[model samples]
Target: MSTKTVRVLALVAFLASALVPAAGWAQQTLRIGELAGLTGGIAPYGVQIHNARLIAIDEINAKGGISVGGQKYKLDLVALDAGAPGEAVKVFERLLTVEKVTLILDGIYSSVEYALGPVLKSKKALLIWSGGNDPATTVGVPNAFRNHFDGGAPFMKVNELFLKKMGVKRVATYGQTGHADFKRFVEEYLPKIQGIEVVATEWHPFGEKDFFPVLTKLKGLKPDALIVHGFFTDGITMLKQAREIGLYPGPLWLNQYGAAPLMMDEASRAIWEGTYEILKSSWGVTTEAPERSRKFFQAYVKKFGERGFGAWAESGYDSVYILARAIEKAGVVDDPAKIGAAMQALNVPDVPELLMPYKPGKLFDKDRQAYPKIIVSQWKNGTFVPVFSDFGQ
Candidate 1:
């Protein structure tokens, strides 16, 4: 079976099996709507995220579901494909009105999340986003929570950690032209550091596969590093094209997923080696650097047979844990509004097996963002190995 089909079948099995435990309880299953892109250009990411999410749901079911107000309730994850922006809105509506989910995963895409703000407010359902790094989603919405960082903060942190300390003078970037966070990082944050100068910058429109022209432009400048701040798929194509044309950039900082060695062309894989990825967690990082991240990789490979990418999927796995924790803390599963409040108030001691590298002291900011250390990893020997640096909580 294809990886997507396997994941879907597993999801079906979990949804079917979850209800067995709730049979005796006062509460039915608590549904978390995963707003994903399962059939579009971004479908691969959804597959990785939802599959990771299934592992969490299965664990909960195995333990006889969750306890809220002294009653046990099962967890059910419903995957809603947000392909086209309009269709995504309709799917979000269906998840709220028809499926009546207690909460929805932030629609992975920001446009879907933007239109979803009113839906969340209208239905009073909770929304948790892990993959998107944009800050706008949680800025003013009480119902929204981020399992990841504000989009640009990690890049700024990267600048502070690597660029400033290394004393790199000139830098160039390949970023999404219209992306707010990328543009801001290149224009605003990169300039903030004392000695660095952003000499050459190139932009690519969304879904422009061939990056030869842009790479050609960047190669001439030969900056210290080619900081690529595009989406994941674009980064893959750009790196491959850059290498194929015999102008492979060095010390690339890819602001996207890097654990996609399974998907790359073999030659492209070699070219992508040593590229940097600002991520939250990694499998190799667990053993290599001995950081506090989920022991998720081994189990995930065992179950899914090695098609996963992006540590963001690990955040998706953590999302379920955080939401369930919030529900139990609220002592109620019926009201998402109460759960949202509980999520904000959650400062529980971190478990040993946490997927998100939540800070030693706290779990979330006032805006409901996790303060996980920005785990930066690189592609070494076809695996993303964490580059350890001391970061503050």
Candidate 2:
């Protein structure tokens, strides 16, 4: 071969080597926004949910990440602290503008979810939040989706079970103040439920540790059942104070989120004993939970060292999988409309990675709200045992 021919062959070899590296570097980074409460009142739940999300992303990436348009993209989380409703807007804006993340998993107060609706719609970003019971959270906001229980349907079932099974007719409620969902439950749904009389209703300010006065007044009414609504920390405080003041063990106590992981510590073990909680199905580790959920719970315990897992942890884990699947379904990562539609169209068997026990149908309704089955569990000794299940929407 001539020298000129040899030089041409060398040039072709150099071009092929350069193109191979460029093709290998073509992989993209898909940033999922995590707007959670790292500080303030939402921290306790937010930190746990955030950790659960980390586990999900790590698992997804380990499996070679998600595929969209034939390109593999690893998931990256851009987390920001937004505990309060006001701070949520600012941080959410940063997620969209600075972080440039279109898909977000927000696990915090419902008020924060409600407050971010306008921004979510305006920015055309997709959000899957774990908690938001108010209708406005998803009613007018098409971009926002809630993967966990919402509104009063589940609570209505809880009330019905309380009356029929527990034989409790008279009910008194003490709920967190400024909580829109709890307020609606007390004023709207509770009144409409048949065969139950709400003898007395009281409210407590947010983050209030002193529930002795409220419990004393509530106990005076002598209702057959006392239904309390609040976060896990507040539930622990109320349970401890109610036990100290001799109001709970006698009244057939049922509290929301009393079974959260944060309340499983030694400090709350005594009070949480025998207490009942109406919560999302398979919220924590349980033998009766689905096999996938049991594995998820065991993974959490293994990684987080047995702190236990509940609250929005399942929803947070499911949300990550949902986003990944939605991206795959849409076949593209840049278009929010297609991705959001794919997310809304998801159902059981479609996204088998989901841990939440949603019914057989589309994962979301017309309003993008999910209605997962609720479970009634009682804390026996130090663990939660399922008393009843399948009271869904």
Candidate 3:
């Protein structure tokens, strides 16, 4: 062949190589990191939330991966068990530095959320909080989005209701000391309510088996109502001991954390028969929620028995679906800024699966901060029921 013809052949070969795409360049994988407390005082909540997330992911993947800007990307969930602050920090560091996840979905508890806030913000990761109700979680972190209502909001409403509607003048507050958010709910919101006087306030360690001492002190005060905040185990123990010691049941028992459905099953029906609980709407109830909530409730019950629609499970399932919606709306998973903006823009016309009915135009605020609507639920006749809501009945 002539020299010119040989050079032409070489040029053609180079062009063909450049035109061919690399082996792994067809699709990009989007990873979502989850740091849940799977082993601790709140392990049951962590387990249920994790299960809900898995269900959401499975449903989404079954229908095919999320679509972004005309391209489909499969969700890669990296779940880590970080039950305490020390473990949570390590997991956050790994997710940020090693896995390099652009989105983080975890932090069921306030302490873990607060501890992971700085790292997530510094890394510019979109942190979707499932259970951090502390106002401090949203204080300065623009990247952090808490789906759960602020812990103070429920307590504030309950305080007002008890003092104004229920005609309760004096009340005693009890909460778990180890949980920072619950403690702050007592310190900040409980003290601010008018009309109702806090005659006494007590704090117990997270795993305190004996509540007789605290119950003794609370009974002596003889307050009109008792506001108790603790896990299901502790709450059950407190109620059982309170009844066993012949503590007068004249004072109404008001529980903030005991609103979980599992608590009803764990505690005797007689104990919770007439007890008033201020909580999020029950996942089992569909009368107040939208069609999606009803569908999810039925499906969960069908799959996992009647006890599937607990608070933790609902919150967990909602978190994943909301994140998927945000990602779809954003149209770009590579950019955290875009995803964060999309998350703020999400507004569902009806309640999504396993979520309460968010008030109209009350999901996210002007500053991209979430203002969640809350409902007060009561346990009546061995079932969870929505009694009151800040938005409407």
Q: Write the per-residue lDDT of candidate 2 for residues 255-362, one digit (tens) a residue.
A: 765355343677676678887877555555443666777777778878886574665678788888888898999998888888999988887678888887787788
Task: Return the TM-score for each candidate structure.
Answer: 0.85, 0.92, 0.85
lDDT of 3: 0.70
Clashes of each: 1, 0, 0
161-228, model 1: which lDDT tens digit per residue?
A: 76555557788888766566667777888777677777887788778887888777777777776777
Best by lDDT: 2
Off by over 4 Å in 1: 1-27, 244-246, 249-259, 263-265, 283-295, 348-353, 390-393
- The sequence of per-residue lDDT tens digits that candidate 3 reaches over residues 195-223 is 77889989888778898988898888889
What lDDT would each prediction earn against the true structure?
0.69, 0.78, 0.70
Worst 10 residues of 1 by lDDT: 284-293
If both were scored by lDDT, which would come out higher, candidate 1 or candidate 3?
3
Candidate 2 segments exceeding 4 Å error: 1-25, 261-263
